[model samples]
Target: MNARLQPFVLTIAAALLLLGALTYSARAADPEPAEAPRPALTVTVVQPQRMAIPMRIAANGNIAPWQEASVGTEANGLRLAEVRVNVGDSVKRGQVLATFAPETVLAEQAQIKASVAEAEAALAEAAANAQRARDLQTTGALSAQQINQYLTAERTAQARLEAQRAMARAQQLRLGQTRVVAPDNGIISARSATVGAVLPAGQELFRLIRQGRLEWRAEVPATDLGRVKPGQAVEVIGASGSRLAGKVRMVGPTVDVQTRNGLVYVDLASSDEARAGMFARGEIEIGSSQATTLPQSAVNLRDGFHYALRVGPDNKVSQLKLKVGRRLGDRIEVLDGLPADARVVASGGGFLGDGDLVRVVQAANAASAPTPAPAQAAAPAGR
Candidate 1:
């Protein structure tokens, strides 16, 4: 090989080596890429507000008639001839609800009437004889013993007449009682009288709700008895989900011995949906009060305790256990364990844990957002 060619080959090799060194330097200057930080959840914030919450005593009760009447048979040993009104029939006062076989009663009454008539005839004759005897005694035409005997006979006859008249009146009363009538305006709730059943005196034939009115008998705890009073407003919800507005009519005088509960009687407004013997729940409006409350969705239920997720300024979430009270609509009363000015997650708190970082979005209700507190000046060092 020629020495000149060797020198040219070395120069080309040096240029290639320079290019490789420049490429290595550029690769070393570039920085490594970092991983992207993700948020656990994107949420909104809320602040508690002061609102009016109803103070109520919740109670379980039964729906019953305001007053009940038991219509019974007053005629003894009489067969029910006809039933004019059945269960669910409305009746007025003195309305005939049923009729018994009045034939026997009528016969007795007629016999008593005949006896009364005979007694009246006998009394008239005795009065005439007494008057003659008195006149004769005054004139000395009759002996004293004869006069005394005539007076005794007249007196006995008059007394017998009075007794017969009294028996006749009683029979008439029995005859009228054969027709079972309503004592008051009401709705028949029950009827046990059959068409041909022979009923005795005082046997109940029908049960009636007086005046077609109903009541709610609320069983309240003994502790809350003092809070109940007459004329308080009550909202009762029946088992069929029907609501009835009622006013407290009375409070029971005594509490039950076994349950330590008292009964509160509430007279309900006129409603067709309410009936006797229905189970119901009631909320007595004891009063109202100002309370700090939050939306129910913002609170989470865990292990029978309520919790809320509080958002920090650094976009971190802190779980706060809350003591809650009555829930109205979609809001709930916060009794304790939460600050009135706390900025908490609006919803979805169940998915978060303590110390979880979250990305807070703009609040929907800006007016409810808590204002930022004023910044304080730094204190002088070592003052």
Candidate 2:
């Protein structure tokens, strides 16, 4: 071997060793495989439950008197002398409400009585004359024409006496009419009669709420009128946020042509807050039926619609649009768009989006989880 050939062989061996070292270093610096992402959120879930949902019909209306009694004067051209009751006064049946001046009526009655007495005296005289006429006719001592005239006079006097008695009775009735009395037990709602004011016949003096009772005139849609029946329970929500209990009295026979609405008269239980002419809203419970219900926390409102977060077996959530019905406390009826067995996110759903991965925690587990201690300030360094 020549010396130049030996140097070349050693150089080739060194280059090969360096190439192997570089290859090992590159393999060692390669990064490890990345891990799959964990669940981004933890949430509690719930399932639909079957419950009895009450069927109710909603209505709006005004409060009014059950029956308004229009009290008016029957005596004509009588001056009211005294008024015993005013608006808002409670009255009993036959209670005196007002009194007219009785002087004129009494005087007229006295005059009729005197006339009646005079007629009675005249009738007695005529009866005596007729008896005499009859006696003389049998004896043939009086002519038939003269006897008939006496008899006719007697009959005329008798008729006049009866007429005077009838007039006297009429005058007595007029005297009684001077006093205005309550026709029925009620509360006075309005009054137009005043002392010293002369009123004519049939003039209204007071308006009374019969038996102090109030009613709610609910206007229900004509299509739903058939559902209302007598004696059904009603819950009325008043303008002041008070709830009143009532019962359905009757359904109107006809519906309004323009609004296609029928009226339902509901008798409200007596209450101080209930007043006539107040606008109110209410619901009538017709019946009940089974329904699939879910907690309100499980439902979401977005984009003018309701939604629920449905959890799949893969721990992925899908947003579901919901058709919901009547809502009770903390629970809502699921009318459509959801299966009875579906599991939905109970709460914290507002922070989630569709198709997001989630970790489910049961109610018991969530309740039992250890509460994190509030962070404490670090102690001053070796104070």
Question: All candidates' TM-scores?
Answer: 0.74, 0.77
RMSD of each: 9.1, 11.6
lDDT of each: 0.85, 0.87
Superposition error at 221 for model 1 (Å): 3.2
Error of 2 at 81 (Å): 0.8
The reply for model 1, stretches above 4 Å from the true place, is: 1-45, 301-321, 348-383
lDDT of 1 by residue, 1-383 (tens): 89879999999999999999999998899867888677899998888888766667889999988889999998888998999999999999999989888899888888988998998898888888888999888889999998898888889888998999999889888889988999999999998889999878999999999999999999999999899889888888889988888898999999999999999999999988887999998788776778787877899988878899999888888889888886666677788999877888998888888888899887767346332211211111111
* Off by more than 4 A, model 2: 1-45, 310-319, 351-383
Candidate 2 lDDT at 373 equals 20
Instruction: Predict model 1's lDDT versus the native.
Output: 0.85
C-alpha RMSD in Å of predicted model 1 compared with the true structure: 9.1
